[model samples]
Target: MCESPVRHAHSLLFVPATRPERFVKALASGADCIIVDLEDAVAEGSKDSAREQLAQHLPQLTPGQLTRTVVRINAVGTRWHEADLALLRNWTMHGATVMLPKCEDAATLRGVAQKLGDGARIVALIESLAGLDAADALAREPHVVRLAFGHLDFQLDVGIHATADEPELAFARSALVAASRRARLPAPVDGVTTDTGSAERLAVDARRARAFGFGGKLCIHPNQVAGVNEAFGHTEAERAWARRVLEEAARHGGEAFSLDGRMIDLPVIRAAEAILGG
Candidate 1:
């Protein structure tokens, strides 16, 4: 199987599949993963053209770039969905990942996975109540490399008009995070900020996602990449704290100890190890 590009991604930037010219630029933007989106970003009338352009351009990428590239096909049951998978069958030979939008059930994901076959990985985008309800099963799917919240569509699906901070989406966010953890997947990726005009908004949203245990954020613009990366990455202070915890834990011979006036137990030790590993 192909290695997953998203396991440690702090930022996943989306580029419209029709705009092949921007694909290389997006990869160079320092985003951890670049998603070439055919769903939502590509209009219905332009879907075929977008897929053709993507087919022509994908083989041009180096294997390394292909590993970091994610092609977001239309949701299952859509007219374009089969064509999208058909195109990928030939083009993803270098192990590029796929993002399945509006993913809601195991059978659908499993069918897609079987179609893509070995070495194919999927990032499941949970966008509706059905998807949220199926998050646990979706995360447990063997080929699902990551789970991402599509909070914008989810809000529309759930009838919650949320502000930028999205307090209304707290339950969904927590559920996704918990599901991913229980499935032993990497922390789930939070949805896009949507307000690309405000760097502060992006930073705040990214940080908020991190606070909720998300390992990454979806970026709609190249400019948002840096902010998302910074927000999800561990700070020097955090690294220092992790280092101290490890050193003290070693001194205590892996026994529970006190650090910074707080009890350091197995859970705390594991958290520190994760920070330092990142």
Candidate 2:
């Protein structure tokens, strides 16, 4: 699989491609990645303009900013897909990742990979039933590095109206996470929180997504970055416990030991290491 920028990103912020002025602001928002959106966020008539605007602004991004920037282009079958791909293939250093929305097959991704070459990396946004069916193949694709859940569009397509708690999407969430792990990909990214003004709801959603084994989440606004980052970050208590677990395991070397009345072993130490590393 190709390298993934999202593999290390805990908070992904979206900025409208038409809004060039906001590009620098989004990059400075403390978000791990900034997605310059030319899909849902841009009006149909303005797509060409937004595309041009993005090309102009992208080359201006500093090297440090390039690694944190992503471009969310239109779906594969759309009118803008070819043009977007052309720009992406040519502007290799503009961004580290590309978000391919509504991916339902590997063929499209294969074509994208071929067009973008090895320099530009891609992430699949699985948002439809076809996507759910093809996720395994998508995750295993050579150029496809990570999977991201697009819950709002997904629910609308499936005709499901879920409550604020999100219990209805549980099975789907678990399936994607399992698929990513089975394919040895980074934990999938959860969808965005629509409640931009409600930090309470956003934090709740972020925490829920993190518990569901998601490595990161999409942020529609700058303010959501802090909460999403915090939700995914290891707490002081978790870090302290992980340190202690490692210390005890080192004393025993390769053998199993008991700590705080609980068993400490290779599997236990590995889990602690994951927390510390994250």
Residues 85-125 of candidate 2 have per-residue lDDT tens digits of 88888665444678899999999888888888777677899
Model 1 clash pairs? Answer: none
My TM-score estimates for the predictions, one after another, are 0.96, 0.96
Predicted structure 2: lDDT: 0.88
**lDDT for each residue of candidate 1 in 121-224, tens digit (9 for 90 to 100):** 89999999999999999999998999999988998899998875678899999999999999999999999887889999988888899999999999999989
Clashes of each: 0, 0
Q: What's the CA RMSD of model 1 in angstroms?
A: 1.4
Candidate 1's C-alpha lDDT?
0.91
| C-alpha lDDT values of all predictions | 0.91, 0.88
Candidate 1 is scored at a TM of: 0.96
